[model samples]
Target: MASTTIQRSAARTEVEGAARTERPRGAIAFGLTRIAIGWLFLWAFLDKAFALGFATGRAEDGSIDFFAKGQAWLNGGSPTEGVLRYATKGPLAGFFQSLAGAAWVDWVYMLSMLLIGGALVLGVATRLAAVGGAIWMALFYLATSIWPEYNPVVDEHIVYILVLVGLAQIGAGRYLGLQERWERSALVRRFPVLR
Candidate 1:
């Protein structure tokens, strides 16, 4: 009887260990997704800040420089102007356009891009980043009007918002991000919402 009890206890322990070690389906996929999205935001920040020529640079050869000659933000390139003047369309078009190139707008846009990208990439403060990203995407969605021409009534911005929300809900950062350590920090312990 004693041996049977010990064997049963050992078996249970093994089962629990296996369960603990088993990762959920798609955990890796979700982690990759998080990384990809994080890069998306980060890349935008890099491109806009340096005018790396993907969207905001000029080349001496009069060709679109995919790698050089950007109108750096520090050197006085208005990232908001192009979006406001060309991409914006809808009820807020005029309002957004008017605010384009404004000092406050530039600061807010640059800051949000950096913060959101950093948070997502590091897997820290992801919930806050998701919220901010969703808000930013929502504004873009509304500005673009979700038109069929641009998108079939659903676009990249909307997809990004959903993905950001999912990343926050699943704590994707915990799988491969700094979320595990972040959650253990005193600040997170006191304010669970940070998780």
Candidate 2:
């Protein structure tokens, strides 16, 4: 009877240990998704910062440089102009349009993009980044709300906002990011909001 009890206790401990270490289903997929979205933000930052011409460059050959000579933000190019001019269509269209080419607006937009992208890519301060990204996406969605041709009231912005929120709720950074170290840091402990 003593031997049986010991065996049962040991078996239960082993099972519990395994359960504690076991990853949730689809963890890898979720991590990959987070990385992919992070890359999207990072790529946008790179494209705009360097004007590597994905969509903002002009070639000396008098043709649009789809791959080079773009109007880089550092080179005094306004990233908000094109989108604000063409994509804006809601009741606040004029408001956003007026912000185009404004120096302060340009600086804020560029800085926000860089910070958000960097945080997401590095998996540092991801919850904060997600909140900022969601707010940014919400603004874009509101500015471009005229969209029956695309979908019935849902758009890329809304999808991105939802994804950001989901990532935050799931503590996605903890899975494969620097979140473990971040969470253990004194700053995080001192300011729990950073976690």
> In order, what lDDT does every prediction score?
0.79, 0.78
Model 1 agreement with the true structure over 104-146: per-residue lDDT tens digits: 8877888888888887889888888878888988988877665
How accurate locally is residue 94 in candidate 2, as Cα lDDT from 0 to 100?
91
Model 1 segments more than 4 A misplaced:
1-22, 60-70, 150-152, 190-193
Candidate 1 lands at a TM-score of 0.80
Give TM per candidate.
0.80, 0.81
Write down the worst ten-residue block by lDDT for model 2: 61-70
Find the candidate with the highest TM-score and give its number. Answer: 2
| Residue range 159-179, candidate 2, lDDT tens digits | 899999998887777666787
